[model samples]
Target: MSLDDKPDNTAKPHDRLAEALASDMAAVDALIAERMASENAPRIPEVTAHLVGAGGKRLRPMLTVAAARLCGYEGSLHHNLAAAVEFIHTATLLHDDVVDESKQRRGRPTANLLWDNKSSVLVGDYLFARSFQLMTDTDNLRVLSILSNASAVITEGEVLQLSAAEDLNTTEDTYYKVVRGKTAALFSAATEAGAVLAGAPEDQIAALHDYGESLGIAFQVVDDLLDYLSDAETMGKNVGDDFRERKLTLPLIKALAKADADARAFWTRTIDKGDQREGDLEHAMELLHATGALEETRAAALEWADRGRERLKVLPESELRQMLDDLADYVVARLR
Candidate 1:
């Protein structure tokens, strides 16, 4: 389930960055769970922690930590903020898996698959509440505003996606709208909040925010591309899962536009009606290739990643700055 078989280019850079930023020695992990855990509700606490304990990239929270330090944040409260960001991300995954009826995530059984959907939903709610509490503890009005606004945007994005499902008319604009809501909003919040916590200058904070938004969009574009390119072992899920679920992600949407009458009719039948068979995946892959849909999508990701790198120039030269640039490149490089 390794996302990359190319020896993980990010490992050395990530380790170096971690050593440099250097959060609390033992307390960050503890604080992550402690902050996510619910009180006066034993079941909720344990269940919420179970999902938080589930392994992930920890990318969003790490951005928060990095932003805080790059901005010269000297306070310990940034860790709490990082934990809150992680909880929000984990909660979204729990809800997303349920909504998608997905059984696997990050190379393992999804929470909804291992447990019941009921537990997954309830635990997700508990985590969201806990995340809000953690944010409230930060006592920074701007921090609360950032996370809260992002949460609202995320929900709106999900709702739009739900409506867009099985609709063949989904456009590239629609795809960008979905990515902005479902992916970029949180990334922007995580990084922007970090800068805010550090009390960085307005221009610097805005640069990080833009950097995160572009990087997030790039990350999602690669994800959509991988849905067609990779198998379950590499991608952590079956190829064409989004197609089987009738999700109107970028790959499918782009293919729809380029489809000829015959191909368009096929799309209507399979994508719009959810009538698919074993060969359907292969056929759709062919359409994606012949129509140049995959390449078009990959180009969009590359453009965003490049813009993200450009945004990093706003930061002063340092090891942290270089790592952030590399991180942006990594998000979109999976396509290559």
Candidate 2:
């Protein structure tokens, strides 16, 4: 089913935005399906269909379409760009599942698990190529440059994360670098490219870029926080997956920063050496709470959300603008 066909009577802010841009979203979805097809290789469409039909929120593409509309774009080229953005995000998910050995995604079996790692990785590569082809359809060099750079940054971020994983000494600065590269880069690119496509004013484009960057950071921080707080059902993925993977997310990093000697040893054994015993997750939760890491992480997300909202003030007033502001609040609302 198309994204608009989903019955969401009690829709959240992003859902409401999706409804507002229903026509554009429909066009984007159609383009996505058209581009994902490959007559020569049936496996390509099979793998792409499984993940694309998995019911993601499509937030990144929505941001791209919304930004273009907010900037008074009248052409349909934004549809292609939005589809490209979604393809990039889906490709990342497919690859990330393989890299993390993830079994589940979006509350369903992951592509890697349902098929195989080779299928997932190759399909991801195909999607990346498709995304670039879509970008070129616009014939806009600036948009191509922005998205290409984002793809590069995303790869760098993933590599940096691999290096930082299981290292308790990974500093907040390094963490921010990873977040900016992997998460915020695409977000900023999506908004900036939309504005560039619309030929919006330089100041307005800059403002939207800043807004996306902050919103992306807030979104990632909240996702990390939910990893420690929410259950498997609520979060889709397993809770404490980051802990099990030894990824140094913000909450754990904050806890480690404030760790006493005993806490340090516990982190070293479980995270550094991968010597997790029974009840280690419970103990880790206790340390996170004792150090006020969860609370602090929540506060940081709130701050970034506020920063995103503040950046929107520079843009002209409109329904899309209000929804964008609300979208920022909605991202971190789960924490409340």
Candidate 3:
């Protein structure tokens, strides 16, 4: 379904931004469709279309377009950049589902589940290749550099997460680094590359980069928090999937910090040891709340969101800027 399919009463800041950039988004969509097609390997488009056609918020691509428009760009090159951002995002999602052995994404069965791991991985590689081609179409080396660096960082972050997984001693510092790599890299690259394409002033570009980075960090923290607090109906995945998967997130990290002797054993059994039993999730939730980790995680999300909003003050005040600021607020407001 398209962004317009959402109810008017439910219109969020992202919906407002999508409406404002409908024409450019349409162009990006066209480019994406044209690039995803492959005659030699029909499964590339099949796998990609399965995920791309799913009702995602399409937030990353929209960010590229919005950043360009906010910087007074009148060219059509932003559409290519927007499409490139989306391809990179979609590629990552495809590979992530494979790595996580996920069954669902965006409220539907994952591409890997529908097809196979081999198809998902190869198709993701194809999309990455397509993204590079699109980025080079602008003939701007700086744009290429920004996007390429993001791709590398995203890969590094995933590997870092794998090493850090199930480790109770995982620090908040490492958590932030992982979040920046896995989530914020593409976000910052999207906005920064767009500004570079628009020939925006260096200061404005840096501000947009910081804004996107902060926004992405807040967005991921909220996501990790929601995995525990939200249910499958709202979150699409089973509640406490991260706990079951033995992943170390901010809430768990904070709780680990405050764990007493008894709590430490519980964490060791379920998180570090990965020997989760029935009712362990409920007890884990209790510990998280009792230790104030959930509240602390929520506070961190809000702080990052506020930092993102503050960064926007450097840019010219416009409807797009206000919507971007509100978007930052909205990411954390989901906790309410």
Best candidate, lDDT? 2
Q: Candidate order by lDDT, highest to lowest?
A: 2, 3, 1
| Model 3 lDDT, residue 288, Cα | 94
Task: Estimate, for each residue in 1-336, the C-alpha lDDT of model 3 and write its tens digit.
Answer: 132333343578878788778888889999999999999988788888898899588899999998988888898989999989999999999999999998988878998899999999999999999999999998899999999999999999999999999888889999999999999999999999999999999999999999999999999999999998998888777889899989999999999999999999999999878898989999999999999999999999999999999999999887678889989989998875
TM-score for each of the candidates? 0.92, 0.95, 0.96
In terms of lDDT, the poorest run of 10 residues in model 2 is 1-10
- How much does candidate 3 score in TM-score? 0.96
lDDT on C-alpha atoms for all candidate structures: 0.82, 0.92, 0.91
lDDT of 3: 0.91
Q: What is the lDDT of candidate 1?
A: 0.82
What lDDT, from 0 to 1, does candidate 2 have?
0.92
What is the C-alpha RMSD, rounded to one decimal, of candidate 1?
4.2
lDDT of 1 by residue, 1-336 (tens): 111223334476555555555544234567876666556767766656566556565778888888887787878878888888888888898899899888777766787887789888988887788788888888899999999999999988898999988999888898889899999999999999999988999999999999999989999989988988888888777888788888898888888888899999889889888788778888988999999999999898899999988998898886677888888877776776
Better of 1 and 3 by TM-score: 3
Candidate 3: Cα lDDT at 93? 92
